[model samples]
Target chain A: MRLELETRGTRTDKGWRDHDGFVGPRQPGTGPRSDPRGDFPTGPEVGAAMPDLRCLTADGPAFDLHAHRAGRPAVFIFFRSAVW
Target chain B: MELQKSMRDFDAANIRVYALSYDEADALRDFRDAHGITYTLLSDPDSDAIRSFGILNTLIDPNDHPWYGIPYPGAVVVSAEGTITRKFFDNNLAVRAGPERLLWAALGEPVVEPLADQPAPLGVQVRVSLDGDHLAFTVQRDLVVRFDVPEGRHVYAAPAPQGSLAVDVTLDENDRLVQRPIVRPASEPHALAGTGESFQVHHGVFELRLPLAVNSFSRSAAPDITISGEVRWQCCDDEVCDPPASRRFELAVPVSGPPAHALRDSRAATLEPNAAAHFRRMSERRKDPG
Candidate 1:
């Protein structure tokens, strides 16, 4: 599985630029190689515990996936603002 | 969205539908009100959910414009226990999980059905025949279809505008033909062509012919060919067509030999009693509300 991380806005040539990042290389047998500036973190690092956040529904109920899972199953979806 | 409409018709309750986005609640509320959306639309303003799902686009173009950073649209079926049953995270935005297909998945029904109605909003059918062992024919090959439109109803001509009647037919798995059928009145509308036009007298009976190629068969030994496609058309009997509904049909055709060459015997035969009977039975139950 390909993994990605959220980098703070410092273009240092090593962190992911904009929001885009590449997962595993298309061709197999080739190990992942980071660029000189180290733009993207390796898959293992990015795959670490994902950050949990709160969501507000139209009904005004606040939801947090980590707390709501309660040892059960939950689906987290991310969508863009239609305004954009 | 039409997805909700399909879900309502599917009549299943086990799997829940939740649409999430990074938009704020106010934006989601506005969208819901504008579209009269009936499904749940959750807000993920901070991109946390988007990041967790790993669907966010983050690529920047050479022009310095950010092209990636949005979540890749997809659907995931989670079992009651929370395990992921199925996940589809492709980049195609227009494609979605069909209502019936989702129901079937939740119900643990077989992935393939022998008689799922091919949803075609348009009114056109193509027939093909297998000659010997090589070559296949398409509508361009002289295979003709005579649509028996119900009284007071008319099907539009080909090359229809988007969201208009545009029927298509293609051979499915397990299907092999000698010659593919062709369409007649190549340039004239169905109402104008008069010749090679067929009509339906009652509510159910409709007939069409298709030609096939000589070697349309796959290497499999099975004699069944799966016909899968969508139809986009309007059906109105002098008055109303419920909305332009896009229906999909997946059919399994048993290939024995080539369809008889004689015009009188050229009509494609319907499948006999099979699993389709079960579907019809279910439809019957739904129709009887009481």
Candidate 2:
């Protein structure tokens, strides 16, 4: 199954800038990639073999999506925030 | 949060659901405990997996959205054979896929819609009405309520200190409407007859009108909409004050087109004039801007 990933970290390439626009530390990268796909490996699309990726569980355990979904259907939901 | 509610349906379809977020394990645990979430929520603090998904939201300025490494909010359904079967995405950031919609996307079939006509009384001897002749789907309307306390008893008013309970009206979360609580000045300065302690209170019959703004509407062309919530307050007599009391209420109203027969009922129409006056005052307040 195709799964979208949700992001939470605040640090950009630039160290940290206040709302006032004062840049500090490293400058932030434009982060625009010519290719639409950033770093995901190719060939995890429909009718293709699912990619095996290692991700951390919310309870602090190393988990693999394919291993967890062993011989079963699964749905991955990527969302913003529960409280936001 | 709504996803957890449809876990049983997903399970019945042999489809397991997983939610990915940027929150750390500890924060996710706290969120799960607070909301009683039973599904598995994974952590992705660095957003490595999100970037790999090719759906990273790069359009948003990093400075403005530091903590949001959001993936265009969506879901993917995988077959038992590990092949991606379907995907769902929407451009609207404010609206998320509800449980029924998510299940529909996964199963490629229609899901049962939630029922919309449950109604019940919330407050004893209380009345509620809409201020306008016709409800507009895009404009804000007044929900006027008149609360009555039997003679010799009084209920605390706004700004009532921590020790006393104040009359409160809380609207349940709604997807179609944005609700704002009502604010009003207490009746003429007075104190309890026995305590002699100074406090603003509602006695006999008094009115409160709140604003409900329409954000988006359901497909139903009929203006009928049901609002559910609770009213909490405490009453005090000359001798003793009773413990705090609360009740659930469901108020259904016609939103557009023709008004229902109940709206024309003599008892219901009595509060419309007051609602109109309240609207006038509100408009004046907005214009003055002092």
lDDT tens per residue, model 2, B1-290: 44565688888987778888655565566556655777778876566777777666665445433333656566777777877776655433333444554566567754222224723223336666665443444344556666767766778887675887888787887645555448553564456566786877777767666666443323356567777787778887657778888878887776653221122345423523233333344334334537
Q: Which run of 10 residues does model 1 chain B get worst, by summed lDDT? A: B133-142
The DockQ of predicted model 2 stands at 0.20
Model 2 residue B105 CA deviation in Å: 3.6
How big is the positional error of residue B159 in model 1, measured in Å on the Cα after superposition? 33
Clashes of each: 62, 3
Docking class of 2: incorrect
TM-score of 2: 0.43
* TM-scores vs. true structure, each candidate: 0.37, 0.43
Could you say which candidate leads in DockQ? 2
Q: What is the interface RMSD of candidate 1, in Å?
A: 14.7
lDDT for each candidate structure: 0.40, 0.58
Residue runs of model 1 more than 4 Å from their true location after superposition: A1-54, A64-84, B9-11, B60-68, B111-290
